[model samples]
Target: MAIAWSGSLDFTVERSGKSLMGSAVSGEGLVNVYQGSGKVLLAPVG
Candidate 1:
């Protein structure tokens, strides 16, 4: 697997006791996960 991109990628993933919620996000350049970025969506097929 090859990862090709520029800029900085920062994330502070954590867990709080009992929880099944996972937060997935995505953005580029000045748009960061902390400086107010967009969200990534994941779907569960039924």
Candidate 2:
């Protein structure tokens, strides 16, 4: 069998059986992914 990421691609962990809320992008090339504990990321992808 092939393995998959098969997981939530959010920046946080939430109830409702672990759900993702929303995402945002700023002019400074910052993306904020919200779920439980929100995250801020830069365009300088790692």
Candidate 3:
């Protein structure tokens, strides 16, 4: 999860390096990339 409180920011989702093994094997290897300047919050969900 991600939240941008102010200014500007960019958010993207991409396959993680481990994705090469496939989701079934790697447990959905994916990641979130955030760029730019801002007050932001990032959290992980299980």
Candidate 4:
């Protein structure tokens, strides 16, 4: 989840090489990338 406090915020998901380093890492080989100006709040859930 993401929240833009002010200005603008862009969120994107791309392939993560670091996450694919190990087979038992338990990741989907993807990462969330947040860019742009202003303050952004990010929340991660399990």
- The best candidate by TM-score is 3
Worst 10 residues of 1 by lDDT: 23-32
Sorted by TM-score (best first), the order is 3, 4, 1, 2
Q: Provide the lDDT at 45 for model 4.
A: 69
Candidate lDDT (C-alpha), each: 0.32, 0.33, 0.69, 0.65
Top candidate when judged by lDDT against the true structure: 3
Q: Write the per-residue lDDT of candidate 2 for residues 1-46, one digit (tens) a residue.
A: 1122223444533333222332222223233335444334435434
User: After aligning candidate 2 to the native by TM-score, how far in Å is the CA of 19 from where it should be?
Assistant: 27
lDDT of 1 by residue, 1-46 (tens): 1122223434333443233332222221222232234343445555
Residue pairs whose backbone atoms clash in candidate 3: none
Off by over 4 Å in 4: 1-7, 18-28, 43-46
For model 3, the stretches where C-alpha displacement exceeds 4 angstroms are 3-7, 22-28, 43-46
Each prediction's RMSD to truth: 11.5, 12.0, 3.2, 3.8
**TM-score for each predicted model, relative to the true structure:** 0.23, 0.17, 0.53, 0.46
Show pairs that collide, candidate 4: none
Candidate 2: residue 45 lDDT (0-100) = 31
Quality of model 3 by C-alpha lDDT: 0.69
Where model 1 places Cα greater than 4 Å from the true spot, the runs are: 1-10, 18-35
TM accuracy, model 1: 0.23
